[model samples]
Target chain A: MNESSLPFFARGMDPGPSFVDVLRRLAPHGVAGSGAPDHGSALIDTVHGTTVVAIRFASGVIMAGDRRATSGMSIASRRIEKVFAADDFSGIGIAGAAGPAVELVKLFQVQLEHYEKIEGEGLSLDGKANQLGGMVRANLPAAMQGLVVVPLFAGYDERRGIGRVFSYDVTGGKYEEADFQTNGSGGVHARNWIKATWRDDMTRDEAIDLALRSLFAAADEDAATGGPDLVRRIFPTVAVIDTDGFTSVSDDEIATRAEALLGGREEGAGL
Target chain B: MTMPFYVSPEQVMKDRADYARKGIARGRSLVAISATDGIVIVAENPSRTLYKISEIYDRIAFAGVGKYNEFEMLRIAGVRQADVKGYSFAREDVNARALANAYAQTLGQIFTHEMKPYEVEILVAQLGETPDDDELFHILYDGTVMDEEGFTVLGGLSEQVHESLGATYKPPIDRATAVRLGAAALTPADQAPLNAGALEVAYLDRARARRAFQRLKGPELDAVLAG
Candidate 1:
């Protein structure tokens, strides 16, 4: 029964699909799948992130990302989707490469579901964050090629019955943010907004508004961050990760929030 | 070669087939059908966990009866193949025919090469985007495959179940009707009818997303059977 002697496949057998196997199978050739090349990948790529912020409210966690995606001095996309569903119980906000970052989120999502199905049990919140760290570390070679992906993962832990957040670097340095944290180009501006408005016991409404204001402030200062578009009807993606699951704030509600924010309401309200 | 009496190949094949059929006949039968809502699988198993019908992939489902361990292995293989193919190519490309063919090959190989043939009959059901394309591919113990359009049955007492299901089965039936049809097929009319608790049921819902696989349990299953 000892781990040292069992063959790889036999030891790894579970009801759900294997996440590592999927990663290995999906990685590009020898680049991201296995071996030492990916071993230190999280460190190799030094893609500087702008901002990512997470806030804890009465219900769960509120996560918001800017609409802009930047590469070097150029704005890659004005409406690049940065927030993604990690699972029903979680959501992830990425601030690195427009490509690999998104791919990493998708893989994370599949890994969770696959694990849930095969093992008949969901991985712990900490386990999921670590899995992301491993994936980041695995992408070292590609990260060196200017394809770095740094992501902020936030989710509601069903077992703990509370929302949790984790931030990662290109080299897979994972840190659990206790109160709040932000990453990316406009992260400084965004984080300041949260730091000022975030309260000790903010309700879900206050947290959401706080999250929106932070993103608005980020968009106001950084050209790389796109503010809410009244014409195209696009807004920064927002989601709530709570005890229930991850639910994206509907576009209609986002539009309303944007309208209210722009309608003479002072930008900085709460301390 | 042993200097002993040689048995004919025909005898060998016959013995293997009988062994497989007899083993298969000892278990319960399951019915797979393309319903209006989606594809339904009804297995006559008392134990809920030891399911004869299970998900192979997002769009594909597997149902088998006979030796539990043997069919369970095949179920895992089907899952691996489907997952591998889907990951490599597009999800839509993982069709019923491809899975059925793979099962046929493996089952055929085992039937001939191994001393014992797998005493199992399995079904590969896929709910296509359209009703016309929804297919139920049944694979028997001896590597025989049947491309069923509307409905089909497999495992022990198949002759009786299939005959019963065939009479009431209609193309593009609704979800509840399909469930009732499946239960009827597996139940002995001469005895008491099976209630929802006695039957194991799941469906490949067409109305859902890419992955149609879903289990019908608890009150929802009760409602369906009641209807």
Candidate 2:
């Protein structure tokens, strides 16, 4: 559909109809309907939480998330992507139902970028966080039946001229992180690891290395957390946001960094 | 009961049009174009926070002139629609024409059903990966939808500005030429020429992403206008 909507004239159409409305319009009882589906039902899908960590640096912020998805006790996906660019200036990571969680983040990303495009500016960080909260809250009924979703959001606000990070609960409670934050089953381990290694005004390199270490520690302990897979050449996703904009480090670059992080740790332990 | 005062429908319509026009004429104007570098929009706005242009979809952009709050509401509404559409359907399905029609529908509704017509005019821009794919749609306060070929001028004195732009709008102008054209198009024949200091610029750069809307101000704008 070339120039499908020509949105300047598309003002009368209410922000694309709501998903629930779409379901109601297309088929009243279609899949993704209102009720919480039964757990362990054939429709029940496994969820995986990739390790994601955000660290505040002297100049801006560094964010990283692993690329693994586990279903129940099985490695459901080894290369499931979790990190996404929410908009030009921000990033988001997902944990929980791999399917719906990814879906929510995708919608959230589109919503933020969409707002920026339509409104000529993005929602404030607080506004963005609230927007995500509202989306998660909308999924409350689904969450009751093992469809929980949690997300981490971070961005470089041009107005504030600084980097900020936010975390979410299954019920959409948004909490701003002061320095660094992590999410998923391995979150606690990752948070503590970062606490031990983090400092105010750290350089970008130090921030990235510390973020990598925190994720590794989390992966070493949490079943849901995935560390660097050297044999397969799979590594975590990392992004940096400065005054310029949001840019993710290449997978190859991240693999190199992860390899060095592991090597240094092994050497320090004399292993 | 006293008979309704003899007021012709034409007179009443003319009065409403005058009021809408007056409100819109007081605001700064903006110009937009589809160039080889992508879609460029230039506005004579001084506020860094208050923007006259924005992105509404992966490839669609929104530019409004007149009351900021009124246009901003429309902008938010467009965002909601585009985001929802992209979620329910595919990104490629969201286009400029459908959105332009929707805006027309809403503006028509407001013009007829609402207490007051929206005192604003808007432009929707889209950049294609290829030259033939680009689009520009200008929607008026009365829900008038016009497909702008290559370039269009918006806001107050648009007629005069369009006359100035003339047929000389060089097709597939580079970004630099597009910026010069837009800035020139907004300049009045009697007023002093506009420079970077008096203009706010942005572009739908057709970058390697779903959303390509970006605002260019400050030194980046300074460098562009200086040339």
| Model 2 agreement with the true structure over B1-227: per-residue lDDT tens digits | 88989989788777778888899999878888778878889998877777878767767888899999988877766665665566667789777777888888888778877788999999988788865688888998989999877778888888877877765576867877778877877887777768777888989886556557677888887777766
Off by over 4 Å in 2: A1-45, A114-141, A155-179, A188-202, A221-223, A263-271, B1-30, B44-50, B65-73, B109-120
Query: What is each predicted model's overall lDDT from 0 to 1?
Result: 0.77, 0.77
Residue by residue across A201-229, what tens digits does model 1's lDDT show?
Answer: 88777887788888888877887777777
Worst 10 residues of 2 chain A by lDDT: A1-10
Candidate 1 i-RMS (Å)?
9.4
Candidate 1, B81-154: lDDT as tens digits: 66555554667767778778888877898899988999999999988877788888989887889998788888
What DockQ values do the models have?
0.17, 0.25
Give residue A164's error in model 2 in angstroms. Answer: 4.9
Off by over 4 Å in 1: A1-16, A22-50, A120-126, A144-146, A171-173, A200-203, A221-223, A230-232, A266-271, B1-4
Q: Give the C-alpha miss distance for residue B74 in model 1, angstroms.
A: 2.2
- Chain A TM-score vs. truth, each candidate: 0.82, 0.85
A1-271 per-residue lDDT for model 2 (tens digits):
2223223333464434243343344334432425566455435456666677878788788888877788878888888877787776788888878777877777676656555554444588788878888888877777877777888888887788889889888787889989888888887898998887688879888888788778778888887888778788888888998887888888777778888888876553511
